[model samples]
Each structure stands twice: as C-alpha cells, then as structure tokens.
Target chain A: MDAKETVMNVLKDITGTDLSDKMDENLFETGLIDSMATVELLLNLQDELGIDVPISEFDRQEWDTPNKIINKVESM
Target chain B: MVNIQPYGTPEYFALIILFLLPIIIGLFNGRRFVNYETLFSLVFLVLTFGGSKWQQGVALIGYVIFEVITVGVYARYRAKQNNTAPFVWAVIIAIIPLVIVKVTPAIEGGKQSLIGFLGISYLTFKSVQMIMEMRDGSIKEFHPLAFIRFILFFPTISSGPIDRYRRFHKDYVQIPDKDRYLKMVDKAVFYIFQGFLYKFVLGYLFGKLLLPIVAHQAMLQRSAFFHTGLSLPLLGYMYTYSMYLFFDFAGYSLFAVAISYLMGIETPMNFNKPFASHNIKDFWNRWHMTLSFWFRDFIFMRFTFFIMKHRWIKNRIRVSQLAYLVNFLVMGFWHGVTWFYIVYGLFHAAAMIINDIWLRFKKKHKGIPHNRFTEGFAIFLTFNVICFSFLIFSGFLNTLWFK
Candidate 1:
C-alpha cells in the first residue's frame, strides 16, 4: 500500500475507531495513537514495510502519523 | 534502613546472579515450568532477609513475618466475615505496615531508604484486595503458590499498577496454553527491553545530563523565567516520567502478566490508551485502572453506601460527591501521608465530579454543540488541570510548596 493508505490503515488498526480525514499530524492529540500503540505501530511498520526504525526517530513529530512515519522510514 | 538499597550495585548484581543458582539447577533439571516468582522471592529472602547484614535480615524477616501473620490472619478471617467492613479492615491493616515504614526515621537520618513502603505498599494492596474478595466469596479456593507469586512478583516489586486480588485469582486459575505463553514471552521481552530504554536510557540519561542544570538553576533562583524555563525544558525529564512510568510500569506489569500467563492466568489489563484520554474522567478510566477499580469497589462504594444509609444530607451535593471526597482522599493518602498528596487527591476528586456533572449536563441538553472555541478551551482546561495536579504531586514541588 501507498503512504496514505498505510497511514489510514495503521490508524484504524491501532485506534479501532475511524478518523475524520488523512492521517498527517496530531495523531496523539486526536486519539489515533498513544505511547503503547506507538510501539505497536513501530513494530507493525517494521514487520510490514521492511524498514528499520531507529528509536531516536520516534519523537512526537515523527510518530504522529503514518505519512510522517512512512516518510521517516523511507528516508532511513 | 536495612542496608539493602533498591538501586542494585555490582554486589547486588552478583547477589542476584548468585541467587539464581537454584533456578540454574531448576533450569538444568528441565525445570518444566518453574515458577520464577517463587524462586525470585527465595532469592530476595536470601538477599534481604537471610543475607549479610544481620540487622537487614532481621528487618526483612520481621517484615515477612508481619505480612504472614497480620495480613495472613486478616485474609483468612475476612474470608468468613462476608461483608464490606472486612474490605475496609484489610485496607487499614494493609496500610499499617506502609505507614510504620514511612513514618519511622531512618537510623542513618537520611532520606534515601524509605524502606518497606514502596514494595510492601504494593504487596499489601494485593493481599488486602484478595482477602476482601475471599470474604465476599468472589474466590472459592486460593492457590498458595499463585498467591505468593502474585504478592512477590519481582518486576513490579519496585513500582506497581496496584493490582487487586480478584483479578489475580481469576487470572491465576485460568492459565494460558503453551502457544499463548510463548507469544506473551515475546511481547514481555519486547516490553522489558523497551521499558529499559524508556526508563534508564531516555529518563535517566536526561536526568543525569540536565539535572545538574535544573538543580543549579533552582538553587541560584537566577530569575523567574530561569526556573520555569528550566522546569519546562526538563519537561523532557518529566515527559520521561510519563514515558518512563508507562514503559517501566507497563513493562513490569507485562513481565508479571506474561509470566503469570505462562503458568496460565490472564491478569486485568493495567493500561489501555491512557494518554489517549479525551477528558480527565476518560484518563482515569484508562490509566491505572486497577487502582481506580479498587478504590471504586472498596472505598467509593462503602462511602456512598454509608452516606446513603444515613441520608447524610439532602440532594444538595449528592452522596456521590461525598463518596468522591472520601475515595480520592483515601487514594491521595495511599500515595503518602503528606498534605500535598491529600490535596492532590481532593483536587482530582473535585475535577472528576465536575467533569461528570458537565458530561451529564451535555447529555441532557442533547445534540453535539460543536464549537471550535469551546472544544479548544475544554482541551486546554483539561490539560492544565492534569499539569497542575502533577505539579502538586511533584516531589520537589511538594517539598518546595510545603516549605
């Protein structure tokens, strides 16, 4: 799946609740992700996308959304 | 102080590794499911109650003895009392040890060893909850091994999620299948390692790096902004608290949960999406839910029941209001005997009650009155309320405020 699809899918899976729009930023505030769920998300990305996410890359900005996480993973 | 410190040094590591000697034998013996908890407790006994310093060993021995006798007797006695008062009695009796430990001045006259309170605090809470349940007839037969394991689970021996007895009993008997145990182990390994990163790496590193600056600034009182700015930046440190607490406690809880799972038991979920909470009420509902549930069951219910029976007052404030007051104060006091803790709990109780009222009002009024301004304000208010509560609960701030 592409970045957008990946983002939407991960958010839906993690939150188990649909969101209003594209998963860009503020996933934490919007209740789409949390600390534990973020770890889960990281694991999912690693398992699914064949990307190694450095622990340092898991700041609020980076892990806030699938697009951001995807971009970070791709950059890595 | 019992001369044994919580911070494990080289000697501690050596002792711990050495303590594992028996388990190593158990390991070689094809230990077909050795309860690591029982072994750890024995190790702890060897280290704390049966080790080098006679005084230390005596203290631990005394501690274990007291727990076995008072809490032990209470557990058995409450199993027949068949009422709510036994729950109260157990809690009171449980906290007595904590209070004694906390109030007793260290022989060294230093603050380092708040011996017995933290671990035993957790121990007693679990024990008390168990006894009350047995009394209430919630648990029919108790496994002595599982009970010991539940009490002395080493990972959470430091901090805890305030696990209750009913959950423990339920989980212990319903042991997971082998495949599930392996899966839990995988998750446990991840959590334990991840928790180390969060607590030791992210938290301790930041504290070591910036603590000097923060302490120095606090001491100098350089300027108004200096303190707030230092503290704010050190929100990274505090964020580590949020981070550390979640990972550390969650990891530890997962450790116990996974281990318990191996032996076949499903403990209550200690955490869900806590920070994902939309409101303060939502936050409590998600965070430290075991403790919240216990307080509701043991404290809140009793207080409300008492008030209702007496018809304490007319519908002016509601029995629920009084219940919150007592329940939260009990919660705060459970943390410590300090005034700040008391106030902290009271604040939360009021906030929760008000939030409930607001929710009720909103529901009664009907329709989602979506106002961007109101929603933003609500978020800001909720966050500030939480922050201020933390400020009150804060270690340094509480001392400073008291001073």
Candidate 2:
C-alpha cells in the first residue's frame, strides 16, 4: 500500500475510528488519537513504510493532520 | 532586604501582584516591559533563595551558568553534525546536578544537598528538553539570552506544569492583542482565587488540620490489626493523605499557571479531574499531567524505540509493559530513593500492566457491560488504588513499616 493508505490504516486501527474523510482535521484536537496512539502510529509507520520518526521529532503542528503525516512519512 | 518564598503565604501573592502591576499596564498599552519582567524574575529568585537561602541562590546561579554553557555547546555541535555520543553526554551532563541532588539526601541520611535549590528539577527538565530537541533538529536556534529567560522563567521556576521551550518562546516574544490579553487576565483572576480556595483553605484544612490527626491516630493504633497489614486508622490515613496531596499540589499548580498567564505565557495545566479517571492510564493523563507527559515522551517512548531498534523486545505488548515498568520506576526514584517510593512506582507499574490487560480483554468481550454503573465502579476502584498508592508515596509507609 501507499504511504497515505498505510497512515490511514494505522490511524483507523489504533483509534478505532475511520479518519479517511477527516484528512485535514487535527487528529489530536478531534480526540481521534492521543500520545499512546501516536506512539502506536509511529511504530506502525516504521514497520510498514520504512519511515523512522523519533518521538522527539514529533510535533503536533508538523503532523497533526493525516495529510501532513503522509507528507512527513513520504519525505522521510 | 525583605525575602519571601514563592507562594509560601498570602503576602507573597500580594507582593507578586504589586510587582506585576507595571508589567500588566505596559502590556495593556502594547509594550512588553521586558526589563521589568527580568527584574521581577531576579527579585523573586532572591526572595526564594536569599536570606537564609543565600547558599541556594549561589548554587542556582552556578547551575544556570553551567547549563547555559552545556546546552549552547551541544546545540553548536548538533548544528554542524549529528552524533550519538555527544548527545548522550550532553543529556547526562545536564541531568548530573539533579541526580546528585536526589541522591545526596539518601546517602547523607536526609541532610539536603548544599548545591540543591528549589525548582532545580524543573529547570533541568527545561534545559535537557532543549538539548534533546536540538539533537532532533527541531530546535534549530539556541540564543543564549532566550535560553536564560526560558530556564529562569520565575513563575514556574519552583514547581511547573513544565512548559515546552518552543511554545513558551512563541508566547514570550509576542504581545497578545488587547481582547485576548483581557480574556487571559480574566482567567488568571479566576485561577488565582480558585487557587486560594484550593491551597489556603482546603489544603490547610485537609493537610494541616486533618492529616496530622489521622496520622497520629494511625500511629497510635499501629498494632490494631495484625500489626502491619491493615487497620482502620491506616485506612483513614490513606484517604486523608490522598486528599491532602491532591489539593496541595493542584493548588500550587493553579497558582503557577495563573501567574504564567498574567505574564502572557500559557503554561500547561497539571491536573484535570484526576479522581474521575476510570483507569490508571486515564489517571496519568489527568494528574501531574506535564510531569507524566514528560516521562511518556522522554523516557517511555525512547525506551520503547531503543528496545525495538535493537530487537531486544520482539513482542510489542511485552515491550510496552516493560517500558511502563521502567518509566514508573524512574519516576518513583525521582521522588526519592526510599523503599516506599520505589514500591509506589512498582505498584503503579503493576496496576497499569493489569489495566492494559483488562482493556484488551474487554475489547475482545464486547458483550461486557459498558454503562454508567460500570464506569462509576471503575472510577471508584481506580480512586482507591490511587489513594493507596499516595499513602505509599506519603512516606507514612516508612514510618509504619520501618520505624
């Protein structure tokens, strides 16, 4: 699967909610994900997309939305 | 020459408000009174660390200088290149003072470290956070003066809802528009008065008046039930200590955050109805939130990544469980090097592990009741567990067990 697809799948699996439509919404603010889920998403992204982002590098502004997370993953 | 500790009494608040008057007026007229802010910081620092505390004042100055140099050097090195060893050394060096401060009391039989000052831990957290963020390339610039302002931000210098460096810098450099500033002032007033109720009234009643009464009874009735397991007075001691700890710390946090607001920095909050939590994980998200978030981000996630990268922890569930244990253990040790504190940490670790297990099981068993009654029961259980843990954390366990 593509990076965007993988990100969506990870978000869905961890949050137990579908966020495919809310691509531009703030995941943290919307209560769709939290710190624990964020870690889980990072691990899943690393495993699936070969994108290794440290928790230290995780900023809410930089990757608060699905599209931003996808962009970050692809850039990495 | 008048010296007063931060938030130690009502008079301290009055003095701080008087000092903040000019800065507040300056902000209203669209000027930041930066010099006055710096002066207030120095004056408060003197109040906290001056007079009988002059030795601590010296230590704070020396510690600040050392951290500034260390962080400045680390940031320069990181800007040029990314290396693991130097980053590790920088973090170790930054934390060395705190480690010494924490350890000295244990080794010296409770004689406080001479080099220790109030809020050293909070300051160290700020500095070390900068170093870590710098290494990650998130904090690209390291201005020395800005760094000093961030560390010595006096409102939270003593106890913190430990604010983020970048977030604080953003607020510090900008003067909020009048409407926004007015709203902040309103909230600040509410928080300060609410803090008065929490700290002075409820905290005094619970901690000073009731805690001693119950604690004394617990000691007198120490041999009432099986001579070490459980007694009525011990149970009373647990509830009283739990309430005292919450009101005292939460009240202090309100005062800190409220003062930060008055200064135009939105310091993060430390509590959010923690007793209403239905589980250990939820409880952490509510109680001493900044400290817990710090541990989660810095310690737990990092350890999980380290173990995974090395393939040391192949099972994901086991990896998290182990990480939780390590995280709480360090937090426990940070509180003190005592057996009770260590046990308190272990208790939470174990509780969280069980909580995670239950959550997973409940997820599978969808037919299990998930309603208000069950939720209330869960909250009640979590509350008692937390109270028992605070009893352990209160150091009363040491008196009960060893003394």
Candidate 3:
C-alpha cells in the first residue's frame, strides 16, 4: 500500500471512522480525532512508516486533514 | 511610588489608553514604535511591582533571572544534543520556583511564599513552554531579551490568555497594516467595553454583592441537609459564584486581550461562552481556554505520548484516562495544595472520563438520539455538572466542613 493508504488505515484504526473519501476534511473539527487520537496517529505513523512528527511541531491547523498529514509525512 | 495593578481600576484603563495612544497612532501610520512599547511595558511593570509590592518585585526579578538562565542553558544544550535527562531537568529547574511558591503556602500554614509574586504561575507556564518547544527543536534560538518581553508583556502579565512564544513573536515583529490595525482597534474598544460590563457591572453584581449574601446564608446552613451543608443557599451560592467566577475572570481576560491588541499583539482569548458547553471536555475548550489548552498540550498530550512510546500502557482508553487524571490533578495542585482543589481536579477528571465513555457509547449506538432537544439537554447537564465542580473548587466546602 502507498503512504496515503497506510495513513488512512492508521487513522481509521485510531478513530474507528474511515476518512478515505473525506481526505481534505478537518479531522479535529469534524470530531474524527482529537489531541489523544492525534498523538496516537503520530505514534502509529512512526511505528508503521517511521514518520516522527514531534508533538510541539504538530500544528492542528497545518495537519488537520488526512491529505495534509499524508503530504506532511511525505515531505518529512 | 505609585503602584497599579493592571486593569484593576477605571483609572488604570484611562491611564493605559492615554499611554497607548502613541502606539496606536504609530500603528495607524504603519509604524511600530518598538522601543517606546518596550519602555511603556517597563514602566507598567515597575508600577505593578514597585511600592508596597517591592518584595514581589524583587522576587519576580530573581525568578525571571533564574528562568532565563535555565531556559537559556537548556536551549544552548539542546542545539547540539537531544538528551531526555537534560530536557527533563530543564523543565524541573524552570518550575522549581513556581513549585516553591505553590508548596510554601501549603507547608507554612498558609503563609505566602516570599518568592511568590502575582502572575508567577503564568510566567512559569510561558517559560516552561519555551523550554519544551526548544527541546522539540521548534524554537531554534532563545533570545533573552525577546523571552523577557514575552514573559513580562505587562498586559497579560498578571493573568493570561497565555500567548505562545511563536504566536507572540510573529505579531510582535509584524506591524499590522492600517486596515487590520484599525479593525483590531475596533475589537479592542468592544472588548474593553464588554470587560466593563462584565467586570464592573455584572461581576460586581454577582461577586461583590450577591456572593456575600449567598455565602453568609450558606454558612448559616452549615448543619443543613444532615450537616452536609447541602442547603438551597449553598446551591444559590454555587450558581452565583459560578457566574462571578466566569464574569470576573473572563472580564479580566478580555481586558488583557484588548490591551494586547492595542499593542499590536494578538493574544489568544481565554473564554468562549463556556456555559454553553455540552460536556466537560467541551467546557475545558471554552473556559480559561489558554490555560486549559496549555495543560492539554503540555501535560495531557505529552504524558499520553510518553506512556505510549514506552509501551507502559497497552490499552489506549486507560492511557487517556490516566492522562486526564494526571492533567487535572496537576492543575488542581497548581491552583493550590488544598483538599478542595485536589478534589476539584479529581472530580473533573472523573467527569472527563465519564464523558469520554458516553461519547464512545454514543458513537457505537446509532439508536441514540442526537437532535436539538438532546443537544440542549446535554448542554444543560454539562452546565450543572460544571457549576457543581466549581462549588467544589471554590473551597467553601472547606470553610463549611472544617472551619
């Protein structure tokens, strides 16, 4: 699977809600994930894909969407 | 020497406006008089800390120097290395003064710590945040002067809408254009007026006037409801004190933000219709937002990550529950090392855990109704729960039961 699929799967595992179709939607605003889930997502990303997003650098606005998270992970 | 508490009196507001006039004009003309602003902040700081509060002034200076050294050394150390021990030590050393200030009163039979000054907690929050961000490599440089300015920015110095270093630095460096500055001024005026209504008018009504009567009545009923002090007057006191707490603090916060805006810094707000919250979690997001968000980010998120990263807790639900307990317990201790405060923290932690369980259950059960009526009921339930929590927080129960 690609990086996007992996991220989506991780997010689904954490939030118990699929976001494959709503890639650009804000996870926080939509209540799909919160700070707890965000931390979990970061950890899962590290374990699964080795993308270590520091909690300090995790701006909710910048990484609010699934696509944004995928892009940020890719860039990193 | 004249001493002035920031936004303490109507005269303070008048004096601030008169002094801020020059900065306002400078901003209006697309210029930021940084030196003048700095001088203004120093003068206000001196006014606040000088005179009868000279001891606090001395303590504040010593405290600031200590923190600057600790954070500065940590920042320097973090530049080339990434050791968890040093980072933990940095956080501990930075909070040492605040911890002393908090614990001294508890240990010394309510004698205030000499090292404790007004806004010590707020200052420590900012300092610790800087250290944490530096550890994360988010803050690459630590300028002592800039850090001092951020710590003692005077407007929100005493109590904060706890502005972040990066956010404050951005606004401080960039002078808002005339249009944006003008809009800011408009908002500032509105906020200041709203502060007057909340603080002088409504807060005065609830806090100064009604609170005393209700408190006295509640005290008189110390033997009521099976000596549990659970009287109607106590209930009255709860709702009344809740309003007083909200208005008084929210008013002060509005004044802080309004003044920050006049100085061209967009300080984050502290309140957002907190009573309308539908759950404990939502209430936290709305009420004392900066402080709660600070706790959420630094304590809750950090603790959760630490636990998970260490694989100490396999169950995510239990991990979050533990995080909430620590977060609220620390918050309670920060309020003071009192039984009521600690119980208040535990109460909120319980509320949050229960709220989380309900939220999860709701998510699973599609049969659960979630319409306007249900939403309103949820809000009403949350409001009462919060008010009851505030009563526990007020320490009146201590007076009724122990005193």
Alpha-carbon runs more than 4 Å astray in model 2: A12-37, A46-52, A60-76
lDDT of 2 at B141: 98
- Candidate 1 lDDT by residue in tens digits, B1-403: 2445332333553555455555434433434245664666665655443434555455544655565565566656655655666656766776676766655543445343434533666776776666655554555566565666667655345456566555555555444455665575466446545545644565455455555455454534423463443445345334433444455455455444433333344455677766655578667767777777667656665455445445565452465677778888878877766767788899999998897677656745768586977777776677667756765665555433334
Which one wins by DockQ: 2 or 3? 3
Question: DockQ, per-model, please?
Answer: 0.02, 0.46, 0.87
Clashing pairs in 1: B171-B265, B175-B264, B175-B265, B176-B264
Model 3 C-alpha lDDT per residue in residues B37-86, reported as the tens digit of each score: 88888888899999999999999999999999999999899988999999
Which ranges in model 1 have alpha carbons more than 4 Å from their true place? A1-76, B1-37, B48-57, B71-91, B105-118, B140-146, B170-174, B222-269, B313-317, B371-380, B398-403
How well does candidate 3 score on lDDT at residue A73?
A: 82
- DockQ-based CAPRI category assigned to the predicted complex of candidate 3: high
lDDT of 2 by residue, B1-403 (tens): 5667788899888989999999888887778998888888888888889998889999999999999999999998998999999999999999999999999999999999988999999999899899988887889999999999998999899989899999999999888889988988999999999999999999999899998998888888777667773678889989988888999999999999999888888999999999999888889989999999899888888788778768886787898899999999999998888898999999999999998889778867889998999989999999999999999899997897778
Error of 3 at B67 (Å): 0.8
**Residue range A12-76, candidate 2, lDDT tens digits:** 88877688788899987655665656777887888888777768778768989989988988888
Off by over 4 Å in 3: none
Ordered from best to worst lDDT, the candidate numbers read: 3, 2, 1
